[model samples]
Target: MSRASLASLPATPPVLAEFDELLKMRELLLAEPDEATASAVMRRFWDICCGTTDPERVGVLEAAPQYAVLRAFFSVRWGIHLRRLETLASREILADASATDLSAASMLALENYRGIDGELDLLGESPAHNAVVLGCGPFPETLIGLQHSALVGESLTGVDRNHEAVALADAMTRRLCAPRPTVTITHADAEGVDFPAFDLVVVANGLTGKTRLLDRIHRTAPPGVRVLVRNPTLLARMLYDHVDPGPRSGWRVTERRATTALSETLLLERGEHA
Candidate 1:
């Protein structure tokens, strides 16, 4: 579906009201950020965008003049919350003996990764000998999950734009994996990375400019290499970026799997035609 057009048409009153209320809720959540309160607030936000039968709700909201400002506000706040939650959870996991005491958010992420892993298995793709995860945020949940499931056999490299996130993830990997760390965290933009070096590429939902990245991958990655892209679905479109890797320059969509209420995974493979 096409994104809602941001034309000269005035936004409906109801839509403006809904946007106002959402902003109020976001401000409240940002002020306090209590765990229970954050959960409730996020659920309400998701339901307003996703739960209703009116598919146009998301479009209407996005078409509004304030949409860009509101989206930035929501994205920044959500990113902060996720980083804080994951940082605490990562510390606990590293300290714990069994390394199983995961926060609810981390556990949910692992479940999503497992679902993606299953999708790969169904396609006979499995994990590649050398895999790279783009935008592997401060937590590096995707890398950790791959290690936990033994999906990756050789080595895993995590690329992130932020220097602080890269350092934190590097440190976490050393202690979290112990004697022999298979994961290497690096700071780099997706466009600057050498895609041809890796057989598998996993794109994080938080990464923007997805089409550009896909274009780079298609132009560089060798045939038979697999790519897993995490994208938002339904009204969750307001929260994350989504891509349709249709028959493109040299990429074909092998499978699409809905992993959770908010996210879906697209499996694409580099084809011979460029």
Candidate 2:
């Protein structure tokens, strides 16, 4: 229920200044808050992202503000509005809507797709066709893109803990993926998902209880199955839980690729002899 977590990175004074400005805005909104007003605040932050082109700094500055603004708007409303936002955003992408008309949800679908698409090379030589996407939300955009891209196989599976999200994504999948019927959507918690012998598993960002999910994958997935964890970069990590990839976690980071200016994905495998 929190947004804009304090990331412990070395300070960039100007970006820090922007964060302060965001904090001030957050303060005012929290004092007198409503969905419409909070949405307006989100629009201001989105404008900041649109205007800033410097990848080096934009990673930290832009992501933080967007997270803060959206958190203000939809802190606990997890059903209709959130799903609507996701559904519309994804449908716009599928419909090829112009950038000017995209709402916050649509913009997010674009961003997440673009980022995941950029890292498609991470699956190199690893038969990662049968993919299971953890935390598949209302639209399952990542699964859609992966299905279209070369990263996944003929079959794709989406798993989510929320039944509403599962139902919503399933309905969208049936409608969105019209030409093909290769994607399967299931309702299950990340740890308890009865995974088949999949070749790859994609852990989407913002999944609740992420560390335990990783541990479950390590134990439950097939031997040599590759796991990809898409995570927000240092700047956006303030709002989400950070899952480390290294020796202690029984996973080794094989490839680290940037998903967006402010986010990254890592291709990993269980350590040898783990």
Candidate 3:
């Protein structure tokens, strides 16, 4: 049997008492030979951790050991690469925002670190860039970053499915990004939208559900257009699947980092041939 299977042979306690239940969950994942069964168990573990059955909450796995271990195992089985990119992104946002100076809830949201800032940075760097932002939420920080970049001069157009989010993004631009480069936010589904010629595009969250968006981008993007994706796990998955080389076709990936309190931001861009 594989090492993972051996580890799953029986529930064994690690030194951390708090992680005992997590170990049991790992054992279950290991023992299951069926891919579907293992996936279901992993889903259940995340649902319990996130306090909801919604798959979106699976993002909570960043803090849950059971989910983390299962995620590692799944990555190996599926030939995926795993990186703590989101963890890093959250740290940078908090650091930039001085989240430690804020309340607990605010810290939590910032710490969630979904790669919004890094995406913004890419969008900001590409003037006259046509971009699509998936899972663009109500947070104004992303727009703020874009505005700051534009102040020095950068033109960008953005699309999102959430009308409210689009409106908020537009409002943020007017308030924070005014008197400079142009920015437009519109409501459109990521998978179905008509993309224009752009130097760079970004997909923030929606890793699992948004892979299809890549096809849409490819169809509309000009040759040699740059694409930046934030999800580390998805990046790993793409690499493992041998989808295509990136960072060379003008595609690149960068990771954001922060302190233990997740109150600082750092970016590391990885280059690979596409």
Candidate 4:
């Protein structure tokens, strides 16, 4: 629909043309109405966005009004894709107590968090204590990965607003994980979590109102408590929210590293003066 503007407007950039292609592919995905076809369409979209080397191209797209519509559409679809994987994984594991196999998507997600776990290792003694992951979804891969990597200390708690997700995550973790590092999944809002109770706090990528949550943590959590926030990078900006803790956000970046091709992890602590 917005493709007409690309031709009519004066000197439309290549990125705007790419945006038109993305919209067309989105419509194709809708017409197909199947996961395989949808996945193929999205892969093309991903390649187009990810292949762009210039930051200005992304900036151009972000400045366009179509960016909001495209982001809202793709973000929701991405969540749906993940929920599908999570649902499949949960069903299999729940059907058989001994089943441990997870979806490829789930495995890749675990791998991503494994990178974050290594970044946590850089935080010295911070991640060695109690840890909590906010907005852990149906799979809770981050929590499971941390426990498996031995990054968590006495306890690991996952908080999700969805009751169903909490139940599924709790069951999956209990069935799969060992008992040494106690794991608990609870239904709660990210903003209401007791940030001071844990030495390490992880903010999941999908968590909304991150500014408000970070503000709460900054105002409430102790100085030594470290916050690990997941942020999107490159083309991931289309599907995930970017967390920018500016100089005045009362938090300082301790470590920043890419956890995956599309995502990065940021370790933060209270600023020296804040």
Which model scores highest in lDDT? 4
Q: How would you encode candidate 3's per-residue C-alpha lDDT over 1-274 as one tens digit per residue? A: 4556545643433423334554565567657557566645544544344343233443443344444454455545332111222233333444454443213224334544344454445434446344444545444444445545542245556666656556655654554456555767767767766556555565553334444556566666666555655443322231122123244433333434332121222232323336
Model 1 Cα lDDT, one tens digit per residue, 1-274? 1124322335548746877677678567758777888867875776676554355666766677767756766676666655665666566666666554234336644555456555455346365777899988777767776766566678889999888778767766765553332789988998787787787899988787898888888778776778888888765666667787665446787778877667778888777544
Model 1 bad stretches (over 4 Å): 1-12, 15-17, 26-56, 97-119, 122-127, 176-181, 272-274
Candidate achieving the largest TM-score: 4
Candidates' TM-scores?
Answer: 0.78, 0.72, 0.47, 0.84
Superposed model 3: Cα runs more than 4 Å off: 1-105, 108-129, 151-154, 233-274
Cα lDDT of model 2 by residue, 1-274, tens digit: 3433433434446655666556556566657678787667655654554445565775555455345544444333323344566766655544653432223346656666667656677876445658888889877777767766655556788998778678767765665554442888988878787555687888887675678888878777777788888775544454345688668888889888877765678888877534
Top-down TM-score ranking: 4, 1, 2, 3
**lDDT at position 76, candidate 2:** 36
Q: Rank the candidates by lDDT, best first.
A: 4, 1, 2, 3
Worst 10 residues of 1 by lDDT: 1-10
RMSD values for the candidates in order, in angstroms, are 5.0, 6.5, 11.6, 3.3
Q: Write the per-residue lDDT of candidate 4 for residues 13-118, one digit (tens) a residue.
A: 5658877687777667657667788866766776776687577777877888777767878887776676666656675667785576444335545565457556
Q: What does the lDDT come to for candidate 3?
A: 0.46
